[model samples]
Target: MSHPIIRVAIADDHPVIRMGIEAAIDEIPTLSCIGAVGDSSALVALLEQSACDVVVTDYAMPGGAFGDGLQLLDHLRTHFPDLRLIVMTGLDQPAMIQALHASGIDHILSKADDTSHVPAAIAAAWANRRYLSPSITQLLPARGAPRAIAALSPREHEVLVLFVSGLSVNEIATRLDRRKQTISTQKTAGMAKLGIDKDADLFKFASELGLRTARPDTE
Candidate 1:
């Protein structure tokens, strides 16, 4: 039996990566390239204007109105709950990959893997199954992810979430209506609890735990 054509959209900050994904889609007889855009805003606009079955989006496409990383992914998941999403990310960190799964993203393709994996990810996502590329798969077990995140106090959880969501300590303080020193201390304490020393590792850890939606009391 012949399969129905799957309409696909590509969203990546790099023009070359977008072109590569489009090219891959063109080679698949059952897949059609609907639209390709550079950032989150354009992707959102494209989805609004057109219908597609699957989206292959970059993990870190900064400079868009919706921001990037977990923030962009959360927006897409929230607004397009029924849409099949295939995330393409160069961040091979185990925590981040686990976080993507925690956020209900079942398809993740490593950019380091060939663009050929794009079609496979699309197929899996369309069928409501999980698919992770070779590199991303190897990065797992992602052990202790849950316990580490659960160790944080509510306030520390709130601070870490805001920090990884791209807010500085000062910005998070203003947003939460707290003193900057308090925010900084919470961030530091959270990192210590998570056993994360560097800011980069903290981003990975926080992302893995799906903390973007955490709402602790601000008062």
Candidate 2:
């Protein structure tokens, strides 16, 4: 029997991020930034003093214990169970994402996401919908079917390892002492057979297959 506007608060260490989000929030007629705090203590203090429809919290502060966001969420739930939470961070791993999803974080957005997507995630948080960015969602393991085990030639698997580790065709060629065109053809064939397009996806799939030794791409 009541129309409730979405009350929003922000807790992030960066002033620039807060400003950017506030600037974006201004364009949305349905939402407003009623409070913005920096760090965990400020965040907890504000949430205790005021009732917010949603809290846009960051993963860490200048001095936060690990899993600080989860701790804060647990605290918020104890006091204000009805408050909608939208946890956001730059961390983009399936295990971390799965943990956040299971922990009552309704909406998760990656900082690497394009600016236009922020508003949609916020709106979904307000609507109590599961908001997943295309980039982040794609990292989630497939549903309903186990991946087919490809019996790649040992060389094919070896090349895929370097390829996923961010080696360009030329780099892979140099690293493996092979011709560039040959390595390129192999990578292309692997991509087609694996149904993967980008190197990032290739890395994720390789990691899922229990190959987790990407050296962070020296080249």
Candidate with best lDDT: 1
The sequence of per-residue lDDT tens digits that candidate 1 reaches over residues 38-150 is 99899999998988889899988887899877788788889988788888988755556666666667788898999899988888888888888899787655442233466
- Which portions of model 1 show Cα errors greater than 4 Å? 142-197, 200-219
Candidate 1 all-Cα RMSD = 5.9
Instruction: Assess each prediction's global lDDT (C-alpha) against the native.
Output: 0.81, 0.67
- Residue 150 miss distance in model 1 (angstroms): 5.6
Assess the local accuracy of residue 117 in candidate 2 as a C-alpha lDDT between 0 and 100: 62
On the 0 to 100 scale, the lDDT of residue 129 in model 1 is 82
lDDT of 2 by residue, 55-136 (tens): 8777655564323556667877787888777766776555445545655565777777865666787788777788877766
Give all candidate RMSDs, comma-separated: 5.9, 8.9
TM-score of each: 0.71, 0.60
